[model samples]
Target: MIRITKSIISIFLLLSCFTTVVRAADFKPLPQWMKTAVFYQIYPQSFKDTNGDGIGDIQGIIEKLDYVKWLGCNVIWLNPCFESAFQDAGYDVINFYKVAHRYGTNDDLKRLFDEAHKRKMKVCLDLVAGHTSIESSWFKASQKNEKNAYSDRYIWTNDSTIKPEKFVSGKFERNGTYMKNFFDCQPALNYGYGQPDPKCPWEEPVTAEGPQSTRKELMNIMDYWMEMGCDGFRVDMAGSLVKKDPDLKETTNLWAEIRTHFQDKFPEGILLAEWGKPQQAIKVGFMMDFIIHLRNSGYDTMFFNKTGTYRRDTCYFDIKGNGSPDFFIKNLTTQLCAAGNDGYICIPTANHDFQRPCCGERNTVPQLKTVMTFLMNLPGIPLVYYGDEIGMRFIDGLPNKEGSQLTKGNRAGSRTPMQWDSSDNAGFSSGNNSSLYLPIDPSASRPTVEQEKKDPSSLLLFTKELIALRGKYAALGNRGEIKFLQSKDNQYPLIYERRLGKEAFIIVINPSGKDVSVSLDYDRVVQKVFPVLNSSKHKIIDYKNKQLKISAEPLSYGIFQIY
Candidate 1:
């Protein structure tokens, strides 16, 4: 009887373990399409104008769909196109349901969705959930003295006499002042605080009636777009909701609930967060998140540091720069472990909020090529900001347009109009130059896609080759495992191996102005040396004694397929 009981107990334990493993594995299956997707982020104001309105619109995006497809990106992350006052550059949304007049009607955007789908591509629109413009009907209704359904839609103090810091007052006839998420024109939506203060009766908890209703409305807004063929949303300031929560637990729970409902209805729908903390965001059920320029998540060390003016002393991308990859590698490893196999960590070349790869000191074609090599081969999803492929320079010292002025210098330079050719307004618009969204790069050497397309050895062509290489190798795709190989020397050349099941590939990059070599215990035979642009100087020195010696020229990179 004792022996029989022991056997049954062991069997029950095994079954319990098996169930736990299965449940954990099924936490959230990442969308298969996202595993190998290359994202292109389009700043609608500067991408391309079709109707000579000087501002890029949905029809313009449709016109440039072929151009995006040619660049090898399978997904598009378009910036905010909702009706807005253009304060904070469309981040201040005025209406949740209406399309901005400057962009086009709702039908035009839907047509873009249809056209993108025909080309086998996906589109994710920017969803700003934390705040709304002062012109928003919700905000306007909340501002009225009389009580209404929208009165509690925004964060407001109870007493009309007290004005909070970083909040707007006097404009609203309501009893209390409202908080601002970003610019003064943008008011924070009341998602409710994690811990409500007893003294402040107006500080509602997450479980309050108003907060619950707000969550429902947010979900409804998402449903409306998902039904229109939108693939998903790249949530703006995703972590900013659920105020007064230092730990972000309440915010995470809020997103998790939303994600659960969203996935149930649209299983393939992707949710990407702007939150820099991947560890927190991934756990909250986000499919992916970016290491944006908002904070120093080791991204600034590899690219241009915006804290200072253009200088060769700062960025790792520049040949003469003194920047190091140690910081980036350290932060990335932590984020990768936190994300595990559940979500992706996106590394962007340059977003609308930061300087491009060819900006500042890293303005040379060879330097740009080396940077592109690193970007395309990284283990995460690669995001190419609209004009970055052709090496667009950030025009410095332009007047602020659409609330480009922020605490971190004016972003007007990075928000300049896209350069298509040398035509009037750089082919961005036929409208008057004064009416253009932002001034074009005035340099005589401004790089244009039309001119670069004719040149076989241009940066544009090189970017295309890198994209092709990434697609050709399964090991270089988003789901592949990456291991950083130790370099014989300190910093010049960085080596890493990418493995996907049975197949493995090695990538070596030298982002310096001098030649560098590394020795590795790679005894396998080199099947192929994938051609890298401007890397003709790279060569395999020796592969004997169970050790391989490889050298790369200044600003060059190489990929070796091993067998």
Candidate 2:
């Protein structure tokens, strides 16, 4: 009897261990579609104006669906098209259930989803989950003198006169001050606090009825859209939901619960967080998080760092090539190590909030080609910001539109209308130039799709080739294993290998104006080397013993298959 009981106990232990592993994997499994997704981020108001109103709309995007597919992006991350006051662009969401009038009606969005699906692509809407426009019905209801269901939906102090940091008072019948997430016109929706302070009696726990209801409403909003053919959501300010969560423990738990429900209902649905910390965001429920310019992740050291904005004037992708890859590599390595297989780290050429790679000094075709190579070959989802494929210049000195100017800098420059052709208003809109959403690039030589499609060496063609190459190679994709082949002596010519099973490819990028050679001490013996893609005119590659020698020209890049 003792021996039988021991055997049964051992069996139970093993079963329990197996269950734990299975559950853990189930909780945070990366969706299959996200594995190979190449995203095109469109700022809706700037993409294309089909209505002649100078504002881009759903029908306009629907018209450009083929153009996006032709560019090789399978997924479209559309900025918020929901009903909004447009104080902070479209981010100040007013009604979660309705589409913005400027963009189009609900049926137009449905048609967009259908059209995209017809072309074998998916669309992800930007979800402004953290806050709502001050004009939203929920906020209006919450501000009443009498208590209502939404009274506690937002964080409010007990006394109207008491305004804390990031809190606003006045112009309300309510006896308390409300919290603001970003702009003054936006009021934060409460998801509760991590540790409710005793001094702040208004602070509620996550389990409070108000917080619980808010979570349910958020889920409802997601469900409403998913039921309407939406594939997923790119949540804006995903990490800021739970207040005062130092380590984001409670916030993480909140997302974990939401993800559980989200996956159960729509297993294919993905959540892309705007949060810069991929390590923590992926640990929670997000399938992807952006490594943007906001977190000081040294991403700026590569492409976007303005002269005095960062530690160095020269970025890794600059024409002068005075920058070091060490800073960028270190931060990327840390994020990749921490994130592991849980999710992917999304890297963008430049989002709507920052300067494009074609800005300032790094605007040449060779320089842009090197940037595209590095971005496309990396082990993450490459987000091609609208107008970036053709090297659209970020027009400086543009007046702020819809609160595009912030404390850091004015983002109006990057939010200009897309330059489709050299025609009137760059083919963005037929309206008067002054009445357009933003001014078109005034430069006579500004690159455009109409012109680039006819040129073999245009940045647009290079970007397209890079995307196609990434699609053709499983090793060059997100799930592939990346091994940086950097030695102290070869830092300038950044080298890395992407491998999947038996296939492997080495990428070399030299972002400098001078020629460079690097001898990499790799363990594998190179039986043969085929240049898959080469930006350099010379085919300078040799292998001796276990060492591999590669020579690259100024502002050059190459992808080689190894046998």
Candidate 3:
């Protein structure tokens, strides 16, 4: 008997050793403290105003850190605090090391980072390595002469006769005559800076191929920010990094190099790529972006990819005479969930460049709550848009223009300021309220944070609750497998099952109006139900007698436990 007991103990020790090695070799995730923690995204200009400069600054973020923490988020993903011309809301970065004077100094960022760490939250910086601002000194230097070292740092194409075949798809008029820019003035890096524009003669063509020196330069840019005490990088335009180029091996390899370099210093630096190609991108030791897959998969049946989606206020239908409501959100939500199945995702509802989701009431409180639950609860990292929590709407009253600003897309309404209070200027700053960076979201007062906190049903309060709930489950934020569950009703309601070892989560959401009833099949396991959401608490949310009946409210969701 004693010999048998010793044999069991020996096996246990062997298993423990194997498990420890596996854990260490694998990505040791950010502390579980961030698992159920929510992230509050802040657009420096809109979150709060420290000085009366009519702009939000780092001091303002520092001041509001407590409020953000109180909102139940341990991870904070700031849009872009780096110095920029404010074109595309600082996405067009000019300097990686320096914080823009408009936002604050390097000290302010240091202070903010310190404060966030004290709160036990993880912070990720938005890395815009995709493209630097055209006005950036690098571009300036490269454009100055065709012989400068900086000239080869950016992608500039010469050979005015050859056009990137993809560039001629109605978006740009190219008979190999005019050089097209992504945002007109913003020249797409020719991969090599000194190279003349492939369609023009002003600059020499430089292929994105760096041989070796250019990789060193990009490494320097990445190292600069990580050394500034950043926790991770959210690689921008990840898929676009190797675009229309026959040799994408060089670009993807560059990402692998960046991953290897930073992972050494910050072992868990959260290397998340915005690259949507999961098969290739995920294997490269970085997380993937997942929107294209969602729409195609039809997380919900009402929408047919982005094709079925259109604005509710002014939706035009095909001859079918019907429109899908916020079908795009299904794309976004399932995108996060699917990616979570593989790697991490930099999930944000609306960023600077795109039109805001809440423009002209794309979201109601119930709808917003459902979306928040979907966003935070889905696997991957949740990136909150600057003002999405309070249901900040956009205002596109301005006429479309032909210049640098977000003139065409529904961008004006999305970048609106945070509705801090019900006071004039939404308490963003003491500066002249009329001189806001972007116009105040029109329907803000009814759904403001102050009002939401008081009413449990408000969107702001719902956001706080969702973030808090996410903290309770480790699988929600990490490597959990997603099994898309089918709803009994084939209407707008879509359901999916998630299995993370012993923890199983059922997410049921309806992105459109019109109630639907469905039954869920949890054939295998008996469950232990825990409270993850506030709105709906159905005591027995598990399968009984081999069946689970679910009644979903219009434009709402219920998170369930199937232990």
Candidate 4:
């Protein structure tokens, strides 16, 4: 028994070493442009209007390319401009090849691409790979009782008698019911499940002819967009492509195949996954994956958590909040270690699916600045939502517009029209107020880019400064190595070090409502201190004894460069 135990231990150690070596060798370099690229997510419907149509169009985005450039974002991620049925917004894609008429024509989108390229900026469109609208031509052909070329494009059970759970049935003349990915308007495409049950003849394997054809069609769609000068796609629900993928090995393999082919044709083109599991997504050749709000992946605890409410959550960046950094740090560290040099873990301020940073109780400039500091200085690509820089509040209790219905919360609050100015409809539209996409913020004190751009102390200017700082310092970019130096003690402050080769910088944040002092080991001479909003309130009281005493006021942050 003792001999067996020793042998098992030896095998375990050998496997551990082998795994580490394999992971190190398997690292795939991300696209050259992504290393320093800052992404700005644009919700086109609410961005701007050019024709007084009350809806933002492709021309609107084209006209505002300068504004996006001024915001310091090199990459623009447009949320689903594809032709859709608008049931789940653009997620219910009806035509993959055409741009939505509400936005513009195919030529208009192409012009937007050319305009963006002229500014030396890249664009990534949202690709919904897992599903399509029930109204799509493919689905129309699929619903027919007669067999056809596109019959196997979507998932269907054996017969109408055998109804599958969580699926829609009886609406089509086809013998079987089709599976739904999200809303009933969207039907899941048949990529084939990883595991096929013998009893279920409809459960196709990944290698089957039908699934292989689906994969080819998806590639064709990607190829069509790539030829149009689009940089790449921010794939939606990337992990859900292959149903019943228990370990996600099949899904990973599927993406791996696509990556292998995609890289050959478009070397500069990159793929960003919305998959929250970066560990698996990176392994499967995705250049980057988002650490989204789904599954409480520490993102919720950091900024979205609301304190003293029925929700009973704490937001770490809130001034009067009691949120902890332990949860966020642990998850972030694990993901970073796993990612290594393979890909980035994008940290977004907020997305269309969630509330903005300046929402609810955390609407102060100090809170916004501190949060932006943390996002900009972190070791990943920083994604800023459209209106977040101007401190747009997530307007609550707005009725659902463009399928923003979800049980978690009203996403309409976050999808409100971008406040461009203080003019009628906040300058987002010229059409009648009743025809606007979503009503502009009704609050008299609603923030606007025009108002904030004039104020030196506004969140917009502060955000611009932070973006400029990130661009100026290599140690603060996504490629930098991060180390959490002092975050265990909640009373002290949140501190971390970012190192890029020989360059190093220390970042400190005091989110509490009280003054806090922390000791740091900084024997070397301190370089210039970047002036944040409240830098005057932070100071180094003592520099002797090889230990530096740093004091920060409530809801303040500072970045210290080290020689």
The C-alpha TM-scores of every prediction are 0.91, 0.93, 0.75, 0.92
**Candidate models: Cα lDDT each:** 0.80, 0.85, 0.57, 0.81
lDDT score at residue 242, model 1, on the 0-100 scale: 93
- Candidate 1 ranges with C-alpha deviation above 4 Å: 1-28, 305-313, 432-436, 441-443, 487-489, 520-534, 538-541
Worst 10 residues of 4 by lDDT: 305-314
* Number of the predicted model whose lDDT against the real structure is largest: 2
Runs off by more than 4 Å, candidate 3: 1-37, 157-181, 190-211, 288-342, 355-363, 398-408, 428-436, 441-444, 475-477, 487-489, 520-522, 525-544
Question: What digit string (tens of lDDT, one per residue) describes model 2 on residues 1-563?
Answer: 99999999999989965654354467846678888799999999888888777788898899999999999999999999999999999899999999999889999999999999999999999999999999999999999989999999998998988999999987888899999999889999999999999899778999899888999999999999988999999999999999988866688778878889888889988999999989878877798999988687878878765621222466777767677778778888899997888888998988888888778777788888888888889888998999999998777767778888877677887888888877766555465533445656465578888989999999988889989988898999887778888776666788888999999998888988889887878898789889999876788567788887889889888999988
> CA shift at 393, candidate 1, in angstroms?
1.0
Give the per-residue lDDT digits (tens) of candidate 4, residues 1-563. 99999999999989965664464355445678888899999998888777776777789889889998998998999999999988876899999999999899999988988999999999999999988998899999988889887788888887987777867886678888888998888989989989988788888999887789889999999999889999999999888889888866687778878987888889899999988868777877788998877656788777775521113356677677477878878889988988887888998988988888877778888878888888888988999999999888777767777788677667777777778877766555456643435666455678788888899888898888889988888988888988887646644467778889878877887776778787877656654554433454536344566666778788777887766
Distance from true location, Cα of 488 in model 3, Å? 8.4
Compute the lDDT of residue 53 as modeled in candidate 1. Answer: 65
- What is candidate 4's TM-score against the reference? 0.92
In model 2, which residue pairs have backbone atoms overlapping below 3 Å? none
- Best to worst by TM-score, what's the order? 2, 4, 1, 3
Q: Which lDDT value does model 2 have at 470?
A: 82
Deviation of model 4 at 361, angstroms:
0.6
lDDT of 3 by residue, 1-563 (tens): 99999999999889965653343336434343333434566666777776777777888887777777787766777777888876566777788778989888988887887887887766777877656676788666655434676655554444335555322121222122222345533444444322234544424323334424555666686677667676776666664544343334445555656666776676756666655554445545564453432224322322121211222223311112134434544455555544443355545555555444454444456656666666666665566666677777655554332122433334444455677776656655355643555445455444567766788667777776666656666555545556656632353455666667887777777655665566766677565555455354443244667776666655657777666
State the lDDT of candidate 1 residue by residue for 35-108, as single tens digits: 77999999987877777767877887899899999989989999999999987889999988888998999999
